[model samples]
Target: MLQATLRFAQTAYASTKRLFSNLFFEDALGVETNRPVALKDLGLAHSDRVDYDPSPWLALRRILPRNEVGPDDVFADFGCGKGRVLVQAAGYPFRRLIGIELSPELHAVAGANLDRSLPPARRADVELVNKDVLDYAIPDDITVAYFYNPFAGAIFANVIDRLAASVRSRPRALRIIYVNPVEEAAVLAAGAKLTREVRGLRPGKNWSLRKSIRMYTLAPPPC
Candidate 1:
């Protein structure tokens, strides 16, 4: 009984933290990204895609510091739902920001959110593509890629293969920020090295997998 009570308390605290964080960030940024969307609602219930749940506001900053983002770095958010990460990334000095989403509804919402949230002086060139991630080719100039466990199984493997292929061709430094890395093995198999692991924000001995973030770097192939 004592253990159960402790678990409940932990869960409640995490939920409260998420709620306030979302409220604060969304309001401060002038964007609406806290709402959750089901795959079924977006007509992707039968597909391999997962529902849309924005990552914590501070997740990106916690992993990649502002100074670490170079002027040449082009960031892409695979399956960027409602552009929460994209908006957060806009504060950085990335050369460009790209968001690829399979759902047209979410893509539209992401575009709108970016327009409202991104500052006029933001240097990144923002692009929101409404298409399947598998169909979208990973640009060679992209140095950073972010994923929120967008998809799993064969699809995730295929995407990683494309990312690796891009690195093989361009031979540039690549960093992949994967939140809730359910398919981390696929990334490692594609020759990416895990550089960092960030647990959930909730304070406890037990951390939720859904709130974790992993950072990986893919090196260019041997000369």
Candidate 2:
């Protein structure tokens, strides 16, 4: 009974928040981009799957300050669905913003959201790519990457390997902000050390039931 009631409350809260987000953010909002999509529907054979959910704007604001993200950072959002995070991220003065999404429908919506909602000057900073996350090359210049439980296991491992390789090829500061970190073990295995963990605003009142988010960075090479 308790679990069922919690679920109902969560659904109601999500609906109300979605309406508010669409109005204030000036973008289409929901777990379903065009239609409901499940993890299996994505069809990325090797990658363990997760569904899309927009990061709360307040939560994002809290995490960015903890990471010390600044104008010089080039930010990338993996599995950026409907570009809500990307759009919100534009509020910051990052050098550039990149979003990678595999679903064509979500990518199109993301592009449209950026085009329609963002001012021309801010829109210029965005690059929305429709490609498998694995195939999307991480440019050496990117210093910050954001993932909201984009994937786990193999897919997660592969992404970290690529990020590590990028750092090796062109050494620079990089930080990864991961929310709802279900595969934290994989992240730690790939050489990142946890720097911080935090919850969204109104912490004790978690209608969504998400776990505490964690920040990770590559451990300095052994002395």
lDDT of each: 0.86, 0.75
12-128 per-residue lDDT for model 1 (tens digits):
986887779767887777788888899897678745687898888889998998999989999999999999999888888899989999898999889788888766666238988
Provide the TM-score for each candidate, comma-separated: 0.92, 0.82
Q: How accurate is candidate 2 locally (lDDT)?
A: 0.75
Worst 10-residue lDDT window for candidate 1 reads 201-210
lDDT of 1: 0.86
